[model samples]
Target: MEERLQKIIARSGLASRRKAEDMIREGRVSVNSETVRELGFKADIGRDEIRVDGKLICAEETKIYVALNKPRGYVTTLSDPQKRPTVISLLPELGARLFPVGRLDYDSEGLLLMTNDGHFAQQIQHPRFRVSKTYRVKISGRLTGAEFRRLQNGLDLEDGTFVPDAAMIDEINPKSSWLILNISEGRNRVIRRAFEKLGHPVLRLIRTAIADLQLGNLGEGDYRFLKGWEIRQLMSPRRQNERLGKPWEKT
Candidate 1:
């Protein structure tokens, strides 16, 4: 079947459509050994030889959904230029190339989603879904009364003020404090940065849940295929709606 080159790249999970176009414009993409810089180029997936950055890409048609209990040391990206260990290393048995739905900071641990379905990935990660993420955090010192009040109201970071959807001091040790927070946005290092801005440097951070999905007893460094209902609940109406819109389901 013929498709836009950008669509092909995006579907392969190598980059989003916009980024794919940029890759083409930069002469980073080649079809059949010829560098293609035109945005309107189309290629037949069954016959054309397509390569991104000199690496041949086999476009994935089968969608696979997976969840992993990410440990603290692994970065969430597929590959890092620094040669750091990534979450992809944890799923060595995975046959399909899966991309992380959203990133977890290298030092933070917990529930993470990986998949090959672009639409599902966009749906969950896009801000439109308003998916809530829960994190349990430990900070280096007990929260001062003013800091606690400020956190409860909102903490002003230089970049932005984060008013957590829910914030609670779970416990206070003499030297440290344990707290939990729920937030709908995926701002970079928001929890840690927010705490630091409030004068309590974060010692540990772990995401325990995403929306209603819990990490549960899934041991660290383990992954499992999402069940059908789990997929439906997370992906929601997008996948099913598309299938019903297309006639291939009847065939």
Candidate 2:
């Protein structure tokens, strides 16, 4: 069946669909020896000889889903231009190309999902899905009652409003405080930025869960393939909402 060249490349486990589109625009993808740069171009996956970066494409027979307890200082990318270590380095050779579902900054650590299935990655990463992500954060100082209420209600930041599904103080120290926050938005550096705006800069941040999937007992730098039921829970928005005890109206 004919499909967009980017989709074909993504299904082949070469890259995400968005990355494949970027490859097309950069004139790196070719079809039957002809370079195709248009985003609207389509081709038969079975008939056309699709190649990305000069390698022929074929759909991966086995889709891989992994949950990695990403440690700090590792980039949540397949490759890093600066030569820093990446999450891909921690995984064994599974014989299939896998990419991170979302991102954790170089300094943040915790549960990071990696997958070969482009559709699955898209479903989890896209903000529209409203998949809740919980984080255990350490900030510079304790938040005043008013400040805590603001975070619970929502914060109107320079970019957009960031409203946590839930927010609470986990521990209060003399010099620092710990908090547990749950949010579904995927804005870059959102959690860190939110705390910084409130005069308490984030000292540490660790994502503890994504939807119903927890980082339970997964040692740092260790990775394990997701079970069948876990994959289904992540894929179904209704199921996720049910587990979170919240109703999400599709926008």
Candidate 3:
């Protein structure tokens, strides 16, 4: 069957549908040796030589989904230009290429989802899905009640708001404190910057859970494939109006 080019790229796990659309607009995506910048372009996945950045993407394969207990100091990208270690290296041998669903920064660690199912990744990433992520953050100083309240009430960040769905101080000491924050909207450096804005610089941060999935006792750098039941749970139609709704469109 013929599908949108962005859909093919996204389904191939090369990029999100939105990112694929932008790449198309940027002339990075080509079909059968010809650069295709047109939105809503369609192609047959099996016959077309779909290349992104000059690399031909293989035909769709059985989707792979695994969870990694990411340790700090590993970048989330597939390949870092500065030559930093990426989370991709920590995976066990797998035939399908896996990409991190969202991201965990170099300084932060914990449960990170890796998968080759572009549709699955996109669904979890969509805001309407309401997939919340919880993090246990260690800060340099104790948080005042007012400061914690401000986090719950939401504060303006330079780029956007730092509104946590829920927040609580787990523990406190003279020198440091641990706080738990939950937010469904996963934005870059959101948790750290949110606390930083309140004078509580984050010393250590670890994601504890995402939606119903927990980091569990999985050791750092170790990963395990998600069970059939787990995949079914995540794919539930929490929200359906949005690619695989808006394809080849700007995010």
Question: All models: lDDT?
Answer: 0.82, 0.87, 0.84
* Candidate 3, pairs of clashing residues: none
The worst-scoring run of ten residues by lDDT in candidate 2 lies at 242-251
**After best superposition, candidate 2 residue 90: deviation in angstroms?**
0.7
**Deviation in Å, model 2, residue 187 alpha carbon:** 0.4
TM-score of each: 0.70, 0.73, 0.71
How many pairs collide in each candidate, listed in order?
0, 0, 0
Structure candidate 1, residue pairs in collision:
none
Write down the worst ten-residue block by lDDT for model 1: 242-251
lDDT of 1 by residue, 1-251 (tens): 98889999998899999999999999999999999999999998779999999888786767788889999889999889999899989987667889999989989898999998989888888876777788889999878666777886887777778887776777888899888787878788888888888778898898888766778999999988888888877766443211111111100
RMSD of 1: 12.7
lDDT of 3 at 60: 60
> RMSD per prediction, one decimal?
12.7, 10.6, 12.6
TM-score-wise, the better of 1 and 3 is 3
1 against 2, candidate with superior lDDT: 2
Residue 138 error, candidate 2, Å: 0.6
lDDT of 3 by residue, 40-104 (tens): 89999788888999999888677899999999999999999999999999986798789999999
Which regions of candidate 3 are displaced past 4 Å?
Answer: 1-60, 238-251
